[model samples]
Target: MLNILRYLKKHVGMAVLILALLCVQAYCDLTLPKYTSDIVDVGIQQSGVERVTPNQMRDTTLEALTLFLSNEDEALLRRAYAIEDGTARLTVSDSATLDRLDQALSMPMVALYQMGQQGMEPSVLIQQSEQVGVDRETFKTQLRTQIETMADQYGAAADTMTSQMAILFVRQEYQALGVDLDALQQTYLLTTGGKMLALTLLMVAAAITAGMLASRVAASVGMELRSQVFRKVVSFGSAEIDRFSTASLITRSTNDIQQIQMVVVMLLRLVLYAPIIGIGGIVRVATTRTGMGWIIGVAVGVLLALIVVLMTVAMPKFKKMQTLIDRVNLVSREILTGLNVIRAFSREEYEEKRFDKANRDLMGTQLFTNRTMSMMMPAMMLIMNGISVLIVWAGAHGVDLGTMQVGDMIAFITYTMQIVMAFLMISVVSIMLPRAGVSAKRIQEVLDTPVSIHDPAPDKNRDESKGDWRGEVCFEDVSFRYPDAQADVLEHISFTARPGETTAIIGSTGSGKSTLLNLIPRFFDVSYGRITIDGVDIRDLSLHKLHNLLGYVPQKGVLFSGTIESNLKFGGADITDAAMTQAAAIAQADDFIQAKPEGYQSPIAQGGSNVSGGQKQRLSIARAIAKQPKVYLFDDSFSALDYKTDAALRRALSQQVKDAAVIIVAQRISTILHAQQIVVLDEGKVAGIGTHEELMASCPTYQEIARSQLSDAELGGAGA
Candidate 1:
């Protein structure tokens, strides 16, 4: 996973933008619950009277309420209100002054409002004080002292009750002032609802923009990772390719990279946002003071435990899923490529079973992991609903006891769900992370594998311009061993093929004939000794310069999807129509190419599957001939052609390629009977190096190979 994150360095700017957008989205989403509580508390319950300090009141009412306040609070309230005719209008609008006045008057307002509910008006109280032989100011002082003593006895509960009753008093004052109560309620609801709508839309916009930017970053990372893997694989030697199979490499490039892309989007969208919502919800819930914070703690703890158990059970299966997918792909490719061979052997049922086994293994692992992860949603819903029920049950007591308002209870429920949902989002991503981590490691493996074959540095490479540039390839005591092999496949091999000579290597099966020819191109570097071109080691020449001087044709012909003309001109972009036609004629492919309806424009399917074996070989030969390189290496390139076509091709090749060395690796003795030199191999060591006539006279391995394919009369004729 850390290796995969390195790709994100190139996209840091976009990542930061995504994070900022997520923060905005989180802020908007979190604030909506506060307005929801306000719409219920202020809009519906208080008759839209939000302030405990009444906005307007009659002068008699203001003076009556001030009777319960200290001298300083009375002076502050007198200054905060302005008298006009018989009414006092609140002149202070700032929250600080209103809150201070509200604090000063809340208990007094609640005490007076309770007395009025019992049918005792302030006039009645003044008459009672006169009956008791006390002045009105002294009676007011005694009433204020009684209210303060009762509030101190009730502690925090009195504060909550005081605020509720004070709002009721403010509502009655508004009615007395002839304000429209219904209009004020409607205005508060509409205003709060509008703010909620705006916040919701803003949250939606932030979410969409963040999602789009995250997807773009993920897609860019996927593209770059695929390119890097492809270039790395292209530079791999034969040994490196063999180390990681083709099917595994394909899975890594496509399926594994796709996994990383999906996780990247999730990481950007949820990983940063979940914590913001969760922690912010916790803070807001604490402020609600409903004493139900333990419910949220319990829900989050259970959610975490559930997530840990599910991931623990599914992680190993996630690891195995990618390998099983590789197996399925490998089996499918093998059956498709060898379909004809399977049918010829009457092994269709066996092949079907082979494919089914691979497919079932993959399917079974996927099903188990899916079933395990499937339990998460229902379990989360259970936890959420269960906690919700618990909150409502406990919150009902607080509401009945007059400590918590209905709107506060509703807000608490919302915040509890928000906290639970945040954990759920994080848990979902946690489950995905293990699988994506497995995929990241798989992709990283291909990128991190060291290439066994490397080109020389520019200063160390051979300069072809400084030399005569004749293609003289020499293997000087060359020995090669496959990676981790017990012994060398080619031992003490020494040979030289001049620019104007035909040097053919003929050996029985398992004698490293193709392996030896591959050495000239450095497909696998020599382990013990060096092969040189113009006295410069092949390794000392950059791959580009070395391949430019040599044309190679493998035993199995390979062609890409294009027209016949395209395949023939594949050797170099500078190859012309004349050169393509001449080269095709020399390789005896012109007859077939011209006979086709499209001729040079004839389309070839992928891997040349549309063409026959012999036609593919001829086209392969023509492609090399069109290059006109100084040396040509053919590794059993003529096995598919008939005797007549092969003989004609060799004759034309010798005439046209007199100044370039040609090396052929062949299984048939007749293919190289007339060569300028033939190298014979018994095991790994060369047994003879001479003309065919000279080899039949002196070398047993050459005599055995020649007698196996030729009649006594033909052999004697060749010797003569």
Candidate 2:
């Protein structure tokens, strides 16, 4: 959670602004119930059933007594309203503003009560001193006198202000009103008009601005964090990436990040506001001056208990839902990647059943999670209504006993709802939290993995390699091992090939030939010994410098979905048309390539699916040749070609180059019969290092492999 906070802090201003708005909204929310209490107890009920003049109404009643009330003459009020009988502004404009203003007033009054309890206010001290027969009105009279004395010094006496307010209130009267009613309307407007409008507008505008900015900031933080995670993904090696699958990691990056983002956005809008709501509920319950109002506390307690229960039930289930999403993603991926295999085997029914099982499992888990999490809302509503019933039951007795007004009951109900809803929102957030937190932890783990390889700093301590087209290659006791493998694949392998020499390695399967060849290009670092190009160790050479010196055609050829021209350009990124044609001819691929409808411009499907395996291998070889590297490692590159094409490629190659080292790994003796040297291997060890005849005569393993593939004539032809 702290990690998420740090990430979200990048958008702190937006978050803070949104939080500030929610606080304002909460202020309005808290004020409303108390205002309902005041409006019923003071405005409509206390001073009703009177046709007294507006001046008398103002002098006698508390509603008319408050300074910030608004009332209009019949005509102007009608014109300000529309024929449709609604404010011309959007609907939310009026209701939300009115709602918030009521909440604001409720807070200050609650604060007054709280201050008295804390022994920290004139009002609280006065109420305490009431024990000595100092009544509430006595303190009011004393406080009023003190204010009047201060006002005289400042030329602001209370009676003078009252007389001025009376004259001033009457002057702003609507022209259409009779004097008696007009005075009353004017007094209401004088007190509450500007303050109510300003407070409502400020709270509403702040709430809206805050919501918008917080959502934007959350999204921005999510984007930056996601990009950072992706950047880290690029640096991880195969071993590290295997800890999480492609689908799982992708889900963590996209969906998991988004979940955490929503948590951030909701927390900004709710956590601070929730506490305020709870406090307001406490204050309202505590300050209920009415008879038997203790039931409000019981109702409030039950609501809180329900929220805690729902969160506890829902959190773990939500976590399972996230894991299920990853599994669903994995299942769908496997089905798609193996679609062709499934169809060819006529197992659509089986695969469909497999997909259905995974799909249903996902649906079941999510349904459980949704049901559990959604229980919070209904559970909250039930608790709210249950408490409202209790409050009504208690308030009825208070009303009967002349201690509580009907509006007090209504206001108590409203305050209870707000408090419960705020907790309900918090509960939903609580449910979302554990799942998103788990996901955040998962993403962080991937980002924290260390990169295996890094370049040494440019200094004399590191060997520097610089060359152009020197084809000398050497392996001195070179042993290459995979991470955590039981043994080295290549052991104590000492060999060298000079420029213009064709060195062929012939061995049975699993003889470490491919692994040994992989060492030259630095695809994997040699585990035990040094492999060098010319006299420079491969590891000491920078990757860019080292890779520029050799061309490797992988055993399994791969092609991107693009034109043949584009795929070949990957070799050097700038091969000329002439060079491409020359490379194709040398690779014995020119005939079939020209046979295609678009020739060099022909589109190659992904993995060269549009072409035959032989054609794909040939194109791969052509791509390798186009680079014009000093050394070319062709690992089982000719396995797909027929004898004729194979013979032609070698013939073209021999004539085309005399200053490049060529190492070929093949299963056929005929493939390397004319090579300058051959290294035979058995298991992971080198068996014999000699020419074909020398090996045939001296090494039985080499001789036996040759006999299986060739007759006496071909075996003797190897030494011809």
Candidate 3:
């Protein structure tokens, strides 16, 4: 989660904007419940009653009492509202003054209480009205007459009072003036409904805007991650690539990045929005003063417990799921690449089962995590519905005692649902987050692995105008071994190949032919001794200078997907068409390339799948030739060509590449028999180094290799 946050910090400003929009959406959604409660409680249920505030009650009572009371009585009545320690006291000198002030203050209180109990039966009404010692019937009848007189004097302004005096005054005005209460209720409902509809629309717009921003930010994050991961993978040398296989790297760059992208979208849209709704729902419910608040807490606790349990069970599976995906990709890639062999060997069913095993492993882990998450919705629903039932059950008693209104009870249920729904949203996103976090850690692993190969200090790097280093390569007691190998693959090897010379290394199988050639280009640094160009150690050269001086062709020729022209120009973008043609001609690829309708413009499939092995090898050699480097290292490049094409290509290379040091690794002894220098290797040790005739006379390893591939006449001519 912290790693995910670090990536999000790159776009903090946009994330803040998304949060602001989501908050606006949540506010608009939460506001609707309050308006809904108002529509029910005030607009419809209390349409005929006046809701007078304390200020209105005080002002109206003062107006009515001014004509009858003295200044002292007025002061005493005003002090009745200013209660000390919860008791309202009027400072009156005599019974007359005290009675007058009491009458003035009691009028509004009695009117307000009577107005509130209007819908009750007579028995209930008598008990609920103010506790003055008057007969119920006479009190009610006189109360109505006094309220009408007050209304006639005060006019319509009497309806604004919160006290019972103002309520009775408003009731008297409505009855006498013949106003329709039902019509008033309808008008208020329509106004409240219109406001609710407006808010809902605004909420919808904000939600749409938030979704768009989330998608944009998530996609940008995915793109950025892919770019960085790809660049990092490209910079990795053999050691790093070996640490993480090709299939796993592909999964990390593609599948893992997609996982993080989806989670980012959910993080912005659902995860972030959940807290605002959850906390805001809590605040809204609290302000409504609903007595059933504990139900929401209970539901959240149940949800949290379920989430914790499911995560504990499913977290391990999520981590293993990615490795299974890598296995599937690895198996699938192997089957596809080896399809012909699999078919030839009649192992179709076996291969099918092999693939199915990998597929089933992935399926099993996915099923576990998905099935665990699936339980959440049904469980949350049970909690939600159960909470709803509890709220209604508890709230019904409040309604019976008139402690809570029907509308307030309904709003409480809605807010409770919102709170639980918020938790539900978070739980759903949380399930995905753990998986994405696993993927993020995997991606971070790739980005964090250091490259094995690095350049020397700037001062120690190679210079262009230094000695005759242009085409000279020297191996001084060089030895190398794989990372975990028990012994060296190449041991105590020393040799030098100078300009205008073809120094061919001839060895039988497993003699470290390719490994020895790879050292000159710094593909793998030597384990024992140093290799040099001219008189300077190869490690002292910057990678750019080192690679720029050598043209290396691997044992297996690989091509990218593009036109032939693009493939040739890949080594150097500045290679001219004439240079490309000359390189192709020297590699003997010009004939085949020109045979195609488009020649150099012909399209090649990935890995040169469109071309034959020999054509691919020729194009690979042509690509290296186009670079025109000072040294050429060919690792079994001629193994794919026929003897005739091989002879012609080597002849052309010998004449055209006179100034470059050429090192060839070949299994065929006939190919290197005419070279100026021949180094024979036997089991990673240098058996002999001399011309072909001298080696055949003195070295048994070279004689054995030469006698196996050549006729007596051919060996004799080579010895001449």
Candidate 4:
């Protein structure tokens, strides 16, 4: 989580501001509950000094506005008539009347007594004069009715506000405050209830503002971290990629970042609020000076228990959910990639069964996690109610002893409730932390992986290779192995292919031809000895320099989801129209490409699934030819083409790439029989290296392979 936070400076300030807002709001919300407790304790229980016929007060305020407006309108009409007769007075008594009316109507309904002051504001008398030019009864009658209606409405407002504050109103002890205190309490209940409720709402608005701000901050920071992780993953080479695949990386970047974001924002709102409630409850308790230690103790105990339960039950479930996500992704990928195979085998039911098992497993894990987290809410409520009951019992005894005032006892009970609620909030944190922890761990794994390919030293000389890699290849005692494999896939081997020569590798199966060829591009570093191009050790030169000097068409004929032109131009960005036409002609692929509905602009599905294997292979060969590389390695690239096309392609490529060296790895001996050199392999060892005539005369392995494939006619043709 802290690691994720390190990237927050770019966009974290907004999140921080939001958190601050939510915290401020939450504090206000906390204060309202406490304030209502004060209102009930001091005004409702102890005194009636707090007084209002709320509707009458409202009506008075409205009537004040109505009277002022009526007088002003009449004064305006009189001024219009006077102006017409050129008898208007600039300093009329109407001004004085309007001033007096404005003062009365605009007096704000705020708590003067709570501000440590008391009583009504100074009175303002509005003087109705002849200049006003309005009927006095008309103003008085309208203002009176408006005042009456406002009074009725204010009463309902005050009544409803007080009732809603019931949760914060401490259980009463009316007898203890005596008559004056009791009257004051009654007056407060009637007049100040709405004021307290409104204050509570102000606090709530602040809290909501804080929650929204904090969530946005979390989201913003999460987004930055997601980008950071993705950039790192993108730069990682094949080795690092193998450790965390495409699906897992995607999950970590999105879901894990979201998890962390939520936790941070939630922490800002809820954590900040908890402390205010907790501290306020404590202060209220200590000020009341009552001994309700048992109630507090029980509340704390319940909180700790809930926390423990959440950690024990929900923690593992959180971890389990992340694992289930990986399984679900794997199933989805399988269904997509193997759609054809599944259909061919008529196993849609089998795939569905596989998916169902994975889906159910994920559901079960997530369901368990949700259930455990949810248990905290109800458990919290139960504990809170129990604390409330205990407080009433304890406060009642304190009330009887005269050691606690009725008002004080009420306030203490309010504080006791706050403590329970605060503790319940702490319990909610327990639920959130577990899931976030699991997600954090998952994210950390990707960040920690070391990129497999290390950059070479800057000081390494460029002249280490010979002749712009003019394809003078040599393998001197070369060996190679996979990362996880126990044994080498290729043993000691030695061979060379000079410029304009064709070197072909042949084996029955499981031969290291492709693996050996892959090393030339420095795709995998050699395990033993050295491989050279034009007498240059392949690794000494930069990977870019080495790869650009050669063209490789792999056995699979890789193509992206784009048009044929785009895939062909992938090898050389600067390829021209003439070059594309020439390369396609050389590979014998121009006819098919031209025949397509959109010709070279025709869309190819991912992996060239839209084209036949032969067409895809031809396009791949064409792409390599477009590069005009000094050397070309064809790893069984012609396997998909018919014998006639393959023969034609080989002949055309030989003439076009006459000056460039070519290495061919083939399963069919006929494909490479005319090569300058043919290397035969059995298992991981090189069996023979010679020309076709020399291999047929001297190498038993080569002769046996040749005899098995030939018939009387073909054998006789070769002899002739």
Residue 400 lDDT in candidate 4? 60
Clashing pairs in 1: none
- Candidate 4 RMSD computed on C-alpha atoms after optimal superposition onto the true structure: 14.2
Per-residue lDDT tens digits for candidate 1, residues 1-720, read 686578788998999999899989988988988888888889998877787998888787787777788888999999999999988999998999989999998988888788889976655654565675677778778988889897887675786788989899888778878999999999989999999999999999999999999999999999999999999999998998899899989999999999999999988888878998999899999999888888987998899999999989999999999999999999999999999999999999999999999999999999999999899999999999999899999989988887888888899999999999999999999998889999998888888899888888878877654456788889899999999999999999999998899999998999999999988888899998889887789999888788888989999999999999999999889999999999999999999999999999999999999999999999999999999998999999999999999999999999988999999999998898888989998678999999998988888888888888999988876543
Best by lDDT: 1
Local distance difference test scores for all models: 0.90, 0.69, 0.81, 0.70
- Cα lDDT tens digits, model 4, 354-373, are 99999999999888887877
338: Cα error in model 2, Å? 3.4
Best by TM-score: 1
Decreasing TM-score order of the candidates = 1, 3, 2, 4
lDDT of 4 at 153: 54
lDDT of 2 by residue, 557-626 (tens): 7788999888877777678888889989998888888988899899988778888888889888888888
Query: Which one wins by TM-score: 2 or 4?
Result: 2
* Model 3, residue 667: C-alpha shift (Å): 0.6
Candidate 2: TM-score? Answer: 0.72
